[model samples]
Target: MQLLYEHRSPPRTGRKVALIITGALMVVALLIFPPEGLVTTWSLWALACALQLAGVGLLALPPVIHLWITRREIIIHPTGPVRRLPIQHIHDMELSGTEEDPVLTLHLRNGEELDLSDWTDNVPEVMALLAQLGVARRDA
Candidate 1:
């Protein structure tokens, strides 16, 4: 029941931020310095601007905002502040990758795999916890 790892991931990714900023700048540049006959009507330029913003907005999504690991199981924070997953369906772990960067894949009995970011930062702690709990998981 002891807590092992708790991580609060960032809301926005770096690549997504860069893309959004670049899109905004391009829109500003288009309005300030219009291309020759490319956007003759204000309505056409407005439509383009709307589409750009909409695309960026759709791409902006929070992947893994929070993670909690306990001796019993892992608890991923509820997405959008709602819809908490049950622990009754707790699954087993399948470790992969080299020692330098380990990847943990939790497999449910329903044949669905939980997608987890490489929680490498807490690898040592997790290993120590597993050792304390007398859990030996050797990946082949």
Candidate 2:
């Protein structure tokens, strides 16, 4: 099968690095100076700091969505999972939203509808690829 279109979201590391630095500094500051004896136990402080850091790290790492469009199917690779939707299985596609921000909804034969806009912002390109594959599209 020939690969027609491919899209990979750019890596976002600047915000992640900044979040780590800020979280570390806050943790250090709290450790150096307690909030007027608000917390008596060091164990609680340590646990709080650990939880805060973990939350910040998780927020910093956003899920990346990648798309591989071929003549036969559209493969969506998100973070750690892969989903392949064959062209034939696509009963129809709905194009909604505004022209500047369009939302592409794929209706599968299994009564499943996936909003492609959630996965990526390049809906126009994906719509074009589907058009090339002769898939039926409905404007909503």
Best by TM-score: 2
Best by lDDT: 2
> What C-alpha lDDT does candidate 2 achieve relative to the native structure?
0.77
Q: How many residue pairs clash in each candidate?
A: 0, 0
- Candidate 2 has a TM-score of 0.59
In model 1, state the lDDT of residue 29. 75
Clashing pairs in 1: none
Candidate 2 residues 1-140, lDDT tens each?
77787676665655556656665776677668766654654654676666667657766665565777788888888345889898999988999889898889999999999988876778888888798798898766
Give me the runs in candidate 1 sitting further than 4 Å from their true place.
Answer: 1-3, 7-12, 38-60, 65-67, 75-97, 103-122, 137-140
Q: Residue 97's C-alpha lDDT in candidate 1?
A: 76
